[model samples]
Target: MYNLPGLTIRTISVSETNNNVYILTSKTSGAQVLIDAADDAPAILSLLADAQEDTDATTHVSAIITTHSHWDHVRALGEVKEVTKAPTAAGEDEIEAITVPTDIALGHGEVRSFEDIELEVIQLRGHTLGSIALLYRDPRGPAHLFSGDSLFPGGVGNTEDDPDRFLSLITDVTERIFDQLPDSTVVHPGHGNGTTLGAERPHLAQWKARGW
Candidate 1:
């Protein structure tokens, strides 16, 4: 229950893969941001419509933020962008064929502010060339993390794609994200159920011992 000032976080399951598409909104301003668009066109469109209906008429998607450029993470980006007419943003190396917001390429320890909440983009490359995790701290509730594919419940992201990259990602997670946030901080992964940093910390040694 990490409640940022005016921010509302909603997660939707998309595709057969169960990719999680997160929608972040400002309850005060009615501005919205989307994280990942991996579902089918119809499903995403329905979600957008539902979100719009729930908020004010001016409530429109401000941007589409992709945590990574993998096909599963961006399968419906083009369609969603066209429908919402919002700018799309991704890491420099991970952006796909879509138009990227080069001017605002988020990097390690970089903070991007919305209407009321501030998001710190952390470089967690390993899940992909440009994978990133977003950390949000709000006065109302606990801190929140959008950990993309770089982290999950029992362990870190998959390293099968690139063993070296996975190792680096794991290290980044340990020293950067895990070390910084409070143990109770909530982690919203790119897929599956949400978890807490505290629940995952005790196993860090086991994960590191296993190696990438």
Candidate 2:
């Protein structure tokens, strides 16, 4: 659990793929936004319930945002949406590939607000045509990014052997993310532990040179 002045962020690892389902709740209004329904409906539902309990307020998920349309990232999307009845949002280009219905089509620089907290959507291509990362800026501290699988501790998201895709992802990540945000920014990816921009900054050239 990560507590900011106006928000509470929790990550639940679900399914065999170890997909991360993040629940972001506005401390003032108890409005929540869930990122990635990943898998295991029962586990996802339990996480939602636990968040409500922990907050001690009537919490409701305003929307469920998908990072991309990968199967492992959306296995429980339908179930979670049906149970919560919250609208779903994803990158506009992903609408065709997604398995679940989308209520909102997000694009680069679009802002999604949950009560007083706002998340800026960044469209990052390569991992998928419409892969996105959400940037959350707290008034009192460093910003946070939910990078999905587009970023991780060791390197950027997997782009396979496609040099073009790797270049595209790295370019966007460098400009839209690394260059725009402070090094102190906290990056919470789709899986595993979190890392900071400063921690990964030095390795950018290495990642590019290696062509991963």
Candidate 3:
């Protein structure tokens, strides 16, 4: 129940892998944003239904945003889209081959306005070629980050497929995300529990020491 100024962000856990699917709604306009449609159609559908119920009004799911296009992150996207009839948005590079209606092509430092809230997209390419994270300053809660598979608690995203690319992703996390946001900012990662920028900073030295 993180209360952002004009937005309410709810993190819903799905799948055995514990992937997090976020439901963001504008408190002022009731516009909905779904982040990461993980591999569970029933769970996602149920969550949307609950959101509509709780809001007591028909909430339009404006977009289904995928942090990346990996199978684990996007398995339920088509079903969710079919059910909600929301446009799916992703980084151009992330969903290269997938033919989905991309309402927005996110890039580094791009700000997307959804009703009353503004979401800043940060490119984080270590976990995948098109991995991206979102940063926003909510009026109710502290600044928030939706860090897809780019980051985690006490660890970083796995880059086993490409060492050089992994190193670059780690660097982006350190400089772009950690350095850009305040210590009080809350990080809601794609997988695992939430953490703060302050809590994750102390481990930066340790991760850097590992030499990617």
Candidate 4:
């Protein structure tokens, strides 16, 4: 659980892959955005229900955003959306590859907002052409990034040994993320524990040198 001034983030790990499904709820309005319905609708629904705890706010998911088109990342997309019926969104280039239809085709630099919540889309090309990470800059605290598979604790996501893909991904993550955001930024990745930009920033050169 990550609590900010007006926003609360909850994560559930599901499937054999240990995919982290995130639920971001506005503390006041309860307008929510479900990020990566990785697996298990029952688990995802329970996470949503838990969002209303300790408050009278009526929690409802406004949108479902998939960070990329990878199968493991979107295993539960169909069921979750079928039940919640929330509009789905994905990066423009990866939308067609997703199993479920995406209602919002997000381009780079678009701010996806709902009531008091706003998430800026940062295109992280390479892991997938349309791979992306969402940035939530809290008004009262450090920023949070939903990095998906494009970034992890040690390095960028896999590029299948393709130099071009790796370069594209690392470059975007460097310029668009590391360069623009603060070191206090907390990264919530898709399949593992979180990390701070401050912790990983020092290894940027190492990752580039290792070519992974």
- Local distance difference test values of all predictions, in order: 0.78, 0.90, 0.82, 0.92
Residue range 44-143, candidate 3, lDDT tens digits: 8777666664454567887888898878888898888998888888876776844555667777788987666578989887788888898878765678
Order by TM-score, highest first: 4, 2, 3, 1
Worst 10 residues of 4 by lDDT: 52-61
Query: Candidate 2 regions off by >4 Å?
Result: 54-56
Q: Which ten residues in a row have the lowest lDDT in candidate 3?
A: 49-58
The prediction achieving the highest lDDT against the true structure is 4
Kindly report which residue stretches of model 4 are placed more than 4 angstroms away from their true locations once superposed.
Answer: none
- Candidate with better TM-score, 1 vs 2: 2
Higher-TM-score candidate of 3 and 4: 4
lDDT of 4 at 124: 95
TM agreement with the true structure for every prediction: 0.89, 0.97, 0.92, 0.98
Compare the candidates by TM-score and give the number of the best one.
4
Question: lDDT-based ranking, best first?
Answer: 4, 2, 3, 1
Query: Candidate 1's residue-wise lDDT over 55-75, tens digit each?
Result: 564577777888887778888
Those runs of model 3 whose alpha carbons end farther than 4 Å from true positions after fitting are 53-57, 97-101
